[model samples]
Target: MSDIAAEFDFSMRSHGIALEMQQSNYLNNRICRPLVSAQATLVLESANADLLWDQLRRVAYVPGCSKRLAGTNWPDPQVVADELSAFISQAEVYYRAGEETSGPSAALQYYYSLLNLAKAELLLWRPDAIINQKLTHGVSAVHATGNFEDWRVKPQRGGVFPLLYEKRMGVPSSHLPGEINPDQLFSRCLESGMEYIQVRGKTLQAVPLYQTIVTDGTYSWSHLLIEGYGVIQQNKPSWDLVREIFEELPPLHHGNPWQVFALSSRLSLDSFALLIPCDGKYVRSGDGIHIGNLRLPEWEEELAARLRPMLGHPHGYFDGTLTVSLSDSEFVGLTSDLARYLSVYLVSSLIRYRPSALDLRLNPDQAWYLAAFTRQAALPALQSAANEILDNEFVFLDRVRG
Candidate 1:
């Protein structure tokens, strides 16, 4: 357990640096400093080991955490605290020897409980972090990312984790990155024992320090869908295959016949393109379709009309053309459904065709935008669509296959 702790701690440090939270000395003094300075000692003092243990057991009520600790329980904190001189010592032993490959251990359970108790205490002063964030447990894992365990404190690819602990703690922030006091935030992380790990610029760790306060595992179907997509996105080659599947799919609505295009060569510069019926010559504009060499103001309105549903109020400037971006919440919310509806097709299409021609690859926003489409169950719907496309194509099969 000590070895694992050491490794996990090391992972936390390395990941924090990679994420530019601790590595950039500038952030510590600027943003993290003030955050950490907002101490929760009084709260922690009020909640002792027994209270902490109870808080951890309460996690069974949390949706995601309950799922992880399926059939696990830890002893009362008083029992362990009375037996051992120090919590860390017994925690180390129980944590190390308690679990095998199959399931979670009592030690692991206690460790999480203690961590959450600390965070829950902090939440007393910094309620912003947990206010309406719907954070479950301090740790989570789904098969899609090939992570049986997710212990990072924040998300990778530019989110508030190591830099601003509040966001990772489920507290959203209005401040930009590196704009807050770094020193206090770093101090708070040390105080709370939260670990934010990133590998090769990817966030691999995000352990929610407060989630251990409960023991509930029930979750919504949406959570399961995202997990499914995470697994589907694991296959690199399948991205391109997903595009092919799109091309071969029949119209989502048979009478509408406005299914997305299959080949990259047939796409337009808008966020997405659909195969519209034309006599022979291509027609760009229609009731719903807005296309042409329009002025910036007109284009902006058109773009807003297209984006308003997904991004509430679309805001952007024209860099020779109209540009738009989604907030983190907006991106996740929109992408989650997109992935379920289009499945890999939406992801593959983005990879195959860019919203703008100048862009070389999917930007951070775009990549994450596509990530929402990774649901495995959606694949069957796509396959059914493909069969319909095949049935239509066979009527026009120019070349015979053996």
Candidate 2:
């Protein structure tokens, strides 16, 4: 019944088609040869079986209704815009470097990147297609994590870059044939979030990161960490301060109102992924697919040692008898700065993936930790970046004050 209901739901979602649900026993009683006909609805034997009828009757098939639902986890348009710009810049640089084969390869990559950008734009216009849309640029996904070697090939599962590249290089690509109109696609992308500028009386697009790059001889997010460390040391933020900071930060308004994870006693340094909690359940989240567990970096031992004193340790946090929470013990010794940065970064990442109120035994100090990070590092950096990303008249602080 659930499987049938889910299929019906998908049909309604994608094609705006509706399915009528009728009781199985009703068919069995009405039809002379009921055994020959398979039932669309399941038959349950119980005193409370009438309740199931109520559920079936209430299954509403409203076209495009989900669009009105708040907190849909749509990918940030700004990230896509910035990355496409970065790729274009890299391509231009490579093409001009006078390298024999490197120039053509970069040019080809840029071409593919533009097509992917168009596809992303199409998704924005047809929001219903977002769930089914596969990522077009694998490289962009790899770039975000900063762990290139591990994530480089991963995006290929949902992206076309690798197969297309291989085919272009005479590697014999075995894929479906789907061509696009470049002019129309580019126009659509412009309608989405792709920005441009005028160069020598000609319109040119693909200037990276809101057209204002911050070159600090480090990764763009590096300052968040550096500032987080420095600010944590200089300021003694109280819980009250933390609460105020939380209220200021944007709320998670997407799918999955709640995520519950019961911890286990098992612990290991070899694994960067969170341990599977026996009683773990993702409530209200769609599908809840565990995508091979999220990869978190192993913090420096010195930093972890610095954070050990302030952390709490409670036994039985996990299902088994344990001295402390598995994550807490594993995450022990983080420097206050690193901890602060991680808390904020992790929260943002979680919210981006599927915004939810987390109910987990691991690292319960995340709330206060996030508060401190927001007060010290997040707000300041966000404000500065917002000033650059937005026009002079619409700075983040001005909006916040308003």
Candidate 3:
């Protein structure tokens, strides 16, 4: 939802009830009732939310899903993931350094990374998963960004010299997870678009827009600031072709069709976590903490700057939940929290109602044609459909491609 929801609609999202929509009465009495009922259910054959919680903990970060640990040792999924990712990452750093083509933990991070992708794969098949499937890793895009690889090449003794250190096996990680085949990714993205468009109430023959990965990562998306938004497939967005029309692009549109804020391996081996800067460049925020351009208000910029000093979060964007720990109330009160959360609701809804048109078998060429048309002005019907919900209207920010 970070930047992704900005592209679509969000007013329809809800978790039965979101934090922003919380009711005090429900929070106090209603919350405990579900716990009691779940616990009581365990009394018969199997109603152990605690046990569920335990096993789930082995994998998941959330609680109350099981019985055995329901009331005793409550651990936040957010915090647990944060801690586990860090613990595993630390174990990985040491293990990657010490161990080799031997046992487990060496590839634990690798497997964990793929495990995430596997989960995404499960979600992808679901009618609502945004990406039809997590783009399967094709060839390595390690050289694409030039930010990862050779993470820590420890020297090893070798050769004629008794104590001359030769470099050990280097780590191979990319600044972005673009090992994804674009042909497949763009195609599936359009499929998602078609379905999304239809959900807003539209039935056009097709939509053609230069699908861009303005920002892609494990937990964030910001396609709102994309230049190739209105691209047609036959006239695809290549760096060369884009150079010609780059001048004509809107302020929000970054030059290329794709602009990933991939997390570099300087952080971890999983992959570059992403943060699409609407502007082509990611501005430095000083110190070891680097951030790209976010469309936050000036006041928030000042706020983030002030908080940055007080908050010792090196992995602010990367390994949060562990560092800069926060209480449930504190996390709930965050501005970006609800927006980040809406993705969950969106995915669940997508799964429940597998809408047609979101089919992955979309034609990029045809989709681009629609993009060209919409660039001029919204087709009367398409515009109507996009705003069908009335209260939820598209916010194109500026006119004249400025």
Candidate 4:
């Protein structure tokens, strides 16, 4: 875990420079001063992680910026204390919801616990850094709020909306990408979804994070979803894949077919396009679909079918027993497992973390933004940090496959 923290620290330093967070020599001096000294201080204090994470669930709007842990010269420690208080206060809504899921947003309830935990960990370390606007934008902003795991929503592609979802009861769709058109598969899955989105970027790493979900002016439920196809392929996740899965969903009956949401991602600009390609000829406004993707039968089915069976070995992958059992506890374990994977991937991308390399200047505001900005820029290294923990397990899985 210390290794993970150290790597993330380096990642932020490298990224902070790249993003111009340390543009001034004064800022550079301030930011670089803390690295080695703060390492141990930052890593050992792990208490009530969930209590803090619960705050992010309250976020309603996309933030304009983000924070990272890159700066050396610590800003007002007093401000950090105040933000910590706010982070805890806001997270309470989700904590209370977790204790009782009576609201219409059961999906949100499920994610509330995990989102809080993530924030709590970060806030415990740097309260003020989480809110730095220069560090990130939109959904990234939401996560720092300590309100919801805003990281879960599929990234919007260039100002588009996507259909995000809650788990619904439906057989998994079997005829997805391997045989079916990937676009059609996505469309069919979201047919009955409540949240639709349009996006800009192309691909994203599949790691659960806080997401803000709203349509028009009304609030919609925010929950976790897969971000990268690579993650799905790697995990071989089980989801509903039944055809006509959307038939059971009730229409929103309020917003237009083009209602915009708060946490939706722009089209994927990354090398990987995590979502279906936008329909050009059918496209009028370059709209996004925000319908729920989590429980949509089409999505489950398509993903299931698209990810071919782990074959070439034996029928043991699916024996005649015909019964599958997975506990909430198991999923919790999976969530942790997946998070570590993503963190490691992010961490590995960091090559170096010196202020001189950053090549930027920082003012007060810029210093705060450095917290999240550099950390995100260093995601690949953090992701690698997470993966380092899994090397053994992956080898074991490969042996099983063999």
Candidate 5:
């Protein structure tokens, strides 16, 4: 076995005794239950941008809150707070202005809003990182032939884009391409799924994952139930396809594979269940899990992260279900937040610098897609960023009430 896998096995075995002890205590107490759900309901329904702004403001003004949230002490906490507050406030202004405008002008405002928001997020994540240094857009338009498919943007070495990419993915910007095309950006967006099908004639597959408990009378374990597998490829069960979907999942940690095993028998003709083993009997509080071990919440978050390449809101509106998509193409490591940001950046650039090209290409069909993108894309990006910034999952409650 490979060193990593061998080490993982050894660690699992070493924990077996403690796990058994905890399981015994858990059963004797009969109090183990699923922990508090990650989903938070916004009491006052507002725009996601507004919600994010409120959260960011708290990080800025609330003493010691930034350190608590970032998990690190800032050399100059006040400076970081001031910068965060400024950037967030500017972003809110742009977002509000974008909401009041329409057409390419709205796109321009929204792009700037997202850019500022990204900078603020960077500040929160890396309090000591330089933001005032000379930085380019980090991405540039390479081709714009008045066709969305032909439009392309290239990532530069040193810019806010690369910095964001590095911080989020733990990889250098050089790992990305010199240029990215529109189809790549659009195909990754869940909001653009229908548009992708209509334009590219290929369906994007996404399945909701239900969290539940499974047991064999002696031991109970957490499992994620995925239904509608048949819908992926028109009722044909392909193990290769299933593997592909799971392969997209990120590791629970740097060296450990997902502490999840597929119950092969549970793989029926249409659905499947993945067994997600806890480090010990599930505990209500975070204290029970070892700092080095992957916790249940982290497992769920990692699973959700795997779906990052397929851009869109990760949760269902009413049910708050987590959904994962099966890509028809290879993984490009283009997360929804980054892809959406870059896509809008590309559009705004065209509006600002190459208005004639955009005007010439703005046919009825292209305009329809552009309108759809402008309307639906920003929310998901904001929601995703808010989740990262606040270190929690938030579901706006307004839609359910409406």
Candidate 6:
């Protein structure tokens, strides 16, 4: 075996070996389940499109409801509320129509539904900026060749796309590339990750994240760790690679950036663990003050809140494992909301203008792949928009019938 591999093995075998096993079991059995269950209990559940539409419509008619729901106020609460209701009503029409149809026609209906929903959100948040102006789709197709993978979409400088980008990322859309590969967008989607892997035979852009708290009978600290070090090309995982991955992560709302530490000795090659020091202090040993006053459950809640922004709850359902990604050359840096929107936009555009191209894409062999995109993409987009509008992460629960 290589020296790097041997060092990694030894370190894994020796350093905190007992703690490592304890942490793993604790994370799997204790930490992950309750955190996900608690989140699930708090989210709004909807079994069908009608239920979802009703939930959203109720929020739309009330003045300053966005502020009340999400903690941010609209400038003209009544006007924005009225406009929001109208757009939502129209969006509901398209959404319902899309549900009843299939193929390219259904795709177009879903696109319009999402479009109106996006407009409602834009008006609610940026009333003065978009209320009276002529807004374009803000995104366009670069190439609509017969093959969908070969196609690309470009973001225009001015339009709803850039505005939404600015709203979500706090960065101007101009910073985005002149053109983006649809495949890259596909790779980042939580719903489409499996499809991406099946077709491309490569890992999705996201990395799985696991969390655990380690204690020595007196003092305890929470740690975030990622497996699958495929991002590190070399055998030895360098501090530089660790830092690069850390830097690519989205910034936390408050507090200092989490510190990266090697669980293994510096000489080790493969794996690493990151310490998210509570209150910005590294507690390597018992020298640091203990968290004796805080209950373990409370500490877990605190950690979940801190990491919520970076966590990807696949399809709005909190599975125990969350995901984060290292930005690569293929990544366009769009937020998940924007990625879903643009992805749907690309398909809708194809269906509308290039019917023959879409027909070719829906051939027997690839039909299931395209079907997955259609079936899975839109609901997340709506949920994301609703979250933005209400400033809350909402999950759909199936209605139980007696």
Overall local distance difference test of candidate 3: 0.23
Per-residue lDDT of candidate 5, residues 1-402 (tens digit): 122212221112221222323343222222111222344434436446666668767766677665444564576666766777777778778878888877655778888888887787777667656546555678888654666667888898877888888877666877676777776666556666677577567544444444433222222344444444443344232333345444222222212111122122333423433324443333232342322122445544554454343323444322222222223343335555577788788878877876654452646566666667777776766776666566555655443221
Cα lDDT for residue 247, candidate 1 = 28
Per-model TM-score versus the true fold: 0.17, 0.16, 0.17, 0.22, 0.67, 0.67
lDDT of each residue in 219-241, candidate 1, tens digit only: 00000001012222333333232
Q: Residue 157 deviation, candidate 4, in Å?
A: 8.4
Predicted structure 6: lDDT? 0.54
**Segments of candidate 4 deviating more than 4 angstroms:** 1-73, 109-129, 132-153, 156-402
The CA lDDT at 122 in model 5 is: 77
TM-score of 5: 0.67
Clashing residue pairs in candidate 5, if any? none
Off by over 4 Å in 5: 1-48, 67-72, 205-295, 301-313, 318-331, 356-362, 397-402
Off by over 4 Å in 6: 1-41, 44-51, 68-76, 208-222, 225-332, 360-362, 396-402
Cα RMSD of all models vs. native, in order, equals 28.0, 27.9, 26.2, 26.4, 9.8, 10.1
Give the TM-score comparing model 3 with the true structure, all chains together: 0.17
How far in Å is the alpha carbon of 21 misplaced in model 5? Answer: 26
Which runs of model 3 end up more than 4 angstroms from their true locations? Answer: 1-87, 94-182, 185-225, 229-402
